[model samples]
Target chain A: MLNYIAVSTIPIMIFIIIIVGVKEKKDVYNLFIEGAIDGLKIVYKIFPYVLGITVAIGLLRNTNALNIILTPVIPLLNKLGVPMDIIPLMALRPLSGAASTSLVMDIFKNSGPDSISGKMASVIMGGTETTLYTITILFAAAKTKSLRGTLIAGLLADSVAIITAIILINIGII
Target chain B: MSKIWSCIILISIIIAFLTGNPNAVTSSVMSESKIAVENIITLTGMMCFWSGLFKIFENTSLLEKLSNKINKLVLRFFDKNELTKEAEKNMSLNITSNILGIGNAATVNGIKAIEAMAKVNKSDKPSNNMTKFVLINTASLQLIPTSMIALRTLYGSSNPTNILIPVWIVTIVALVVGLVSISILNKIIK
Candidate 1:
């Protein structure tokens, strides 16, 4: 079923593109080439930025940096009765969406999807944005040289989501 | 990004060496190298495909038609018709992409949208509108979290859609809080 949907989407997209191209009398092939070139350029531009972040994430994970760092903060959150399992996910969510997602998938693998922690992971993942990624990529692209109040505001919102998710679960809403 | 990334990797590597586990860094790079290349390839292709489509969308003026409705809401929210044309268009497109859960595509426009906003403001420092743009952009209200739903289904959830309500509620609250606070901060700071 998933395959069917995936396959259908591409053809449907192609069909629409072709129709639109014809309607607009656009040079579809050339426009496509131009877009591909632009895309490659953007990917090239961001590749180093992405590599840097990915390596940092990988090394941090393997070296247990997050674990070590979170140890001190864990007690505080623990005192609030936030589930221990999803703590790493919360810590990583603002860093990279993909990284935290891989962590959430790991949670699902270790525990069933219906588990309390699993639901919480899903909620937090969906509710919050990748704050660091958002700030880094957008601000960098815009050449906003300074870290401004935006970061604080976004992180504050994420914390609200985190607290809300925990509250909802503890109250048995999920 | 450069500063943040360098600080993180540098600190991580230094700590690894100091802890006598430098090999961990090597292994991480080796493993991540393959995955990162594959991801970058996929991301590049995905971006190309969408950009091509959006190019066509533009040529056909379909984008204009589609964004027309969304721009109404944006105009009302921003409470002005004084937005530069490019800014208004980018804002509508960004919102449309986010609602459709095309996040990577949304980022391209999000950057463009904010830049456009800043351009209109004609100020070096972020104006209230620009700051508000980043706040809501990061809050990222989504109608369909495609990745979340897929992950849930893969995990054998009987009803994967169950996460939708919680996600919506949380996101809405975040959006509200972010908007209100950013506006308040804007007044206080500037």
Candidate 2:
């Protein structure tokens, strides 16, 4: 039942939006084309960032450097009941969406999408924003010199989301 | 970002050589770009479709109506008269689009909101309201999480939306913590 609702959510949303657009007598086709072009531009802008982060992460993973780096912390993570596989996702969630998404895909491939670690990764991905990127881009628009409390608060929120996700998964609350 | 990126790549390459796996580095460096391009291609379709749909929302009164509903809830975060009418509208639209999981649209509105707030700001520094707004954005109270769902489906999740409720719970927790912390920090920092 829950799965049914989840799958239908997007389709339902699109239907409603289309219905509303038609009711408003708007030229939905032209607007969609314009917005798609804007979307293409956005993707173009972020491609370099995505490429850079993806390759860096790929190197870290393929060279076994990530495991090596996490070796010392593995026991601590285990003690906390956090799976070692999700360490990269947790670390990268705040830094880069593209990196974290790639990490989640890796988790899905390695553990299968229904595994505990994969579920946790999915929740974390959905729960948190790319804090550093959003902060930089948003502040640049306003020309804010000092981040002051924003950065700290943003990270604190991310930490809370990560912790909450792990706990919820462990407790089988989800 | 540059610093972190360079450090990760450099450290990975160094470790590869030290670990006697320079070949692994070579293979990954060649393959990762292809993987990155593939990921972008996969993402482009979803992004374009959602952006187009959201554009329809924006062109009609749909987004405005939804944002108006969100504005009432958003008002509590700001001081009385702290926001200009334009700032309030853009912020509401930003938050609304964000909740709807149209991230590209949300970003456009978010930047507009910041610009509106900047006009009303007294000092060169960001105001408490501005920080609070950005904090809300960073909290990212998304309702749908479209990209994650799409990726899960692509990866062959038997139940792609299985994590949806948990994601919602976590997002709410994050937003509450973010707002509370920002409120406390605003008093302390200034």
Which has the greatest TM-score?
2
TM-score of model number 1: 0.68
Best candidate (score: lDDT): 2
Give per-residue CA lDDT, model 2, range A1-174, as digits (tens). Answer: 877888899789889989998888999899999898988987787778678777888898899998899889888888887997787678888998766776776677668778889899999999999999999999999997889898899999999999999999998865
Which prediction has the highest DockQ against the true structure? 2
Fnat scores for every prediction: 0.51, 0.81
After superposition on all C-alphas, the RMSD of every candidate to the true structure, in Å, is: 5.8, 2.1
lDDT of 2 by residue, B19-82 (tens): 9989999899889888778877767887777778888887788777899987989888787477
Candidate 2 Cα deviation (angstroms), residue A96 = 2.4
Tell me how candidate 2 scores on lDDT. 0.86
Lowest summed lDDT window (length 10), candidate 1 chain A? A2-11
iRMSD, per candidate, in listed order? 5.7, 2.0
Which residue runs does candidate 1 get wrong by more than 4 Å? A1-79, B1-66, B79-82
Q: Please write out the lDDT profile of model 1 over residues A62-169, one tens digit for every residue.
A: 776656667778888777767666876777788876556555755675676778888899888888888877777766666655655787778888889888887887
lDDT of 1 by residue, B1-190 (tens): 4565576678778878878998998998887665556555546665666566555554566655667878888767684644788887888888777765556557878888877776665556676667777777788577655557656766787666677778888898888888877777777665
